[model samples]
Target: MIDGALAPLRILHLEDSDLDAELIEAELENLEHPVVIERVMTRDAFAAAAVADRYDLILADYVLPTFDGVSALGIARAQCPDIPFVFCSGTLGEDLAVEALKNGATDYITKQRLDRMTRTVVRALAEARARADKRAAEAALQALNQTLEARIAERTRELAEANAALQAQIVERERAEEALRLAQRLEAVGQLTSGVAHDFNNLLTVIAGNIEFLERAVLDERSKRRLAMMRGAAARGASLTAQLLAFSRRQRLDPSPVSLNTTVASMRDLLQSSIGGAVRIETMLQPDLWPARVDATQIELVILNLAINARDAMAVGGRLIIETANVAVAAPPTRPERPSPGEYVMISVSDTGTGMPPEVLARVFEPFFTTKEVGKGSGLGLAQVYGFVKQSGGGIRIDTVPGEGTSIKVYLPRDETEADGDDVKPEPVDCAVRHPPGSTPVLLVVDDDAEVREVTATRLVETGYDVREAGSGLQALAFLEADPCIDLIVIDFAMPGMNGAEAATEIRRRWPALPVLFVTGFADTGALAQAGVVGADGIVQKPFRDGELERKVARMLSARQAPGLRLVADRGRRS
Candidate 1:
């Protein structure tokens, strides 16, 4: 590309039909940039031109009498991987196009959609240029570093102390840069995993909701058994998705002030049984340890995962020490993911086992990245621990030496707002819905996903509430403005246009006394907190157990103290 005018591009076209080749050339010529297409009709010609790397792009037909586009793509990738490869064929199907993309084709198009070729070609070339720019920038960085080191070495005789100080600074900067790179990579992976998990959660909600309805209608012993199995399978799927979300730091967590010393002490017998007779487990508890506000169950799981990982590393018997203490971090350690300087409750898990090398350490926090043999690990062990700690306002650091041992330290922010009864958790009391003892509470369910909205609305309806449906936040608002008899709202967090939080803000402005219960598959907690939605009274995660939503809704509505919220009770409930 040129600033004033588009530069001419050299394109290699592989098509058996002369007419099709001419059409391809015509579409490409229509581009703002000039194009010089070298057309090839035979296997020999195509292979020779592809390996030459003399073209900016390659366009090929999927099928040919003696040659194929896939083979041409392979040759191009092997010889000149930088060149963008696209397939334009009359016989190309959707599945084949997907396969071609998976096999490294830049883009795929059918003859019927040839108009898309020009746009695709333009975008592909731009992306290739971007990739080239990134490579050049990285190369420049390396060159600069090399030049600095060489100059420092040359000046060592005259400036020995200065050289030594500069060398340490250089080493520290390099470590920080490496850590930043790793953090960026893991963050990108977390984003993709969270999106996929959100979709899976929505699907699971539908399946589980329908199954709950079916379980009520069918009571045959054999049928009941099959349904139970299916429900269990659904639960397993939800658990897998939850683990993925946990790795992404997007899973809903219930945090409380808990003592890690007590947690570890309780898990002692379980840890012994889990690790078997191979690894010797020990715990060192700090007497006056400050309580950390974290999800107790998740922390337990994190400890167990660390224990199991240690056990796996030590094929033969080894020592696994779990220690906890209060520490004031002066500064964050040189790690990609680190905690801020603050008071923290630190837990160290040290193992005398086969330690990880640099390559394994780099990807230790990535979801589903494991060095163990296939069937032995799901690779989510460290990822879950990493995400949980990070999400709980904490940091984790790993110290390992090959052939020596490994130690992982987790730093959780000390809970400063602990009250007297914070340690005592209340047992669940069955919430029997009784709104003013004589009226049904009207609830509005808002969601962008139709099936999810239906499932949620149905559940609320079955649970003895009068439920209304809205496909979006705007619609929900409209319903509320028209119907003041509505007592509470159950809204999805993620939506197009105005989201649930935005609507909730507007709803609060108009109806301050009406409470909201958020129903969500996945939520970006930071964003919600910024929007002031995280502190809202109620939230029920998606794929929730049978009674979870009901309990939350019942409690919220009951707290409103009447059949309808606020002024609505004064106006009387609608029939």
Candidate 2:
């Protein structure tokens, strides 16, 4: 499919002769595609059309009764710089054509050979379409990046306010229940932030997908570079959203049995180098340490973040100790929010350096509350640690003095299930499946946003799929009931009246075996379950990359053909 298959070719012609204007219109109609021509015989008509309407190409006669081609070209250039301008005159000389070409005209042609006008108009329209696509991609990327930045700023302010509230509670000797409720409120904010990030991801997915197509359609080095920048910005936005989800304890994770002692031992050399040789390092690894169920990558980050913080605390040289232990707690924890009574793998880190004061310690785990100078830290390290531990069914304790030192302990629940045996879990089937031989599948895309729905449909059509679109879930249901040949359904999660999940349920009731792929900005499992969504079924988040949705759609369709095919559930989170 062509890049601008749906975009119409709009032309603005400046010619005082009615016969010449009609000739130009006839020439335009001779081309394969439809063209809309607006003729202006006077400078006032041309000026009014230039401001009031948008055009793909401007064709002006070299010599007009009132204004020349140069004047019209100037006006078009100033009003719509990206639009193409060309000279179509009967009394044009070689020298005059060269001068006009020098003055931003696309191409100069004589009336005797009006046949050349066809090729010129085609080339100009192609370039104009390319520019329009680039501008639209840039605008979408800019809007997403700005949103990511604004959300980060807003989160920071909320953290600061929570800190102030905590300090006030300390002065008034408020009950512990109040603190618990405050924590719940913070959790609610995290949930809201996560949802917004999910939606942003969906948007990015659409933008990124179209960008990939645009990159292949264009060959210029500058256009490729600009698209690469837009891709980078989209990637950065994805990272920001993942970090927010991590802090909120809503990010999907894959946990396994891991030995705390061995994990720390493996990172000894790396941590030593990361913290520098100035601080002496010591490890007290307990023999036969119990295994804990956690995400090793996240655990490694927690340890590294603590080590980095310890190194920074000691301005000069100091001793840093990392120790592990296996403990069983018979009684309940001092804090009700801590982990339950059970066997746990305890990992502790201690440092001999200047410690945080009472006020600083109180707000240490709050997101974006950093003590380090500006540009030095993001203030998400400890917050991430806290969220990871809690989400992994673990607890964290902090003990510190004003100037002596600080010790932090992390307790992870022991994995004592029978499957703790030395056996590897089988990996899921690859979801990047290709279509079968000589198969042209049909796809139905449902979304409330018109731009997203149209772009998504256009992209799918480009990829060899018969694509149909609907503005809402009700419309999608109506289409599904009427057309029973659609092989797959791609629907948005959040919508007015009937939502993606509701639509999925209704479809399942009618078309029991049909495959459905949800495009959503929501990360809540309970809400998804209520909407009949599962990890087994494919899901593509908002603001996803160009290839992501296609791969997922193809995978879902393939999985439908062959049962017992599984997909990698988690999309994986970024810090």
For model 2, residues 1-575, the per-residue Cα lDDT tens digits are: 12447566778888889898888888877677767788888888888888524887788898987788888888887877787888988899999999887888878779999988888777876776777789999999999999999999999999999999989877545545655764676687667767887898899899889989999998999999999999999888787677667777878878987766557756767998999999987666554455688898889988998999999899897999887778776766544235568778888899998998988976777777899999888887777787888889888778899799999888888876512554433234332243344558879998988888887888789989989877666556545433445678888888876678877776676555667888877755676677566784468887877698889887887777643233321111000
The lDDT per prediction is: 0.80, 0.76
- Residue 395 C-alpha lDDT in model 2: 81
Provide the lowest-lDDT 10-residue window in model 1: 566-575
What is the overall TM-score of model 2 with all chains considered together? Answer: 0.41
Every model's Cα RMSD, please? 35.0, 35.8
What's the distance in Å from true for residue 55, model 1?
99
Q: What tens-digit string does per-residue lDDT give for candidate 1 at 378-425?
A: 888888888899999999989999987899999987877642325433
Please give the distance, in angstroms, between residue 126's alpha carbon in candidate 2 and its true position after superposition.
99
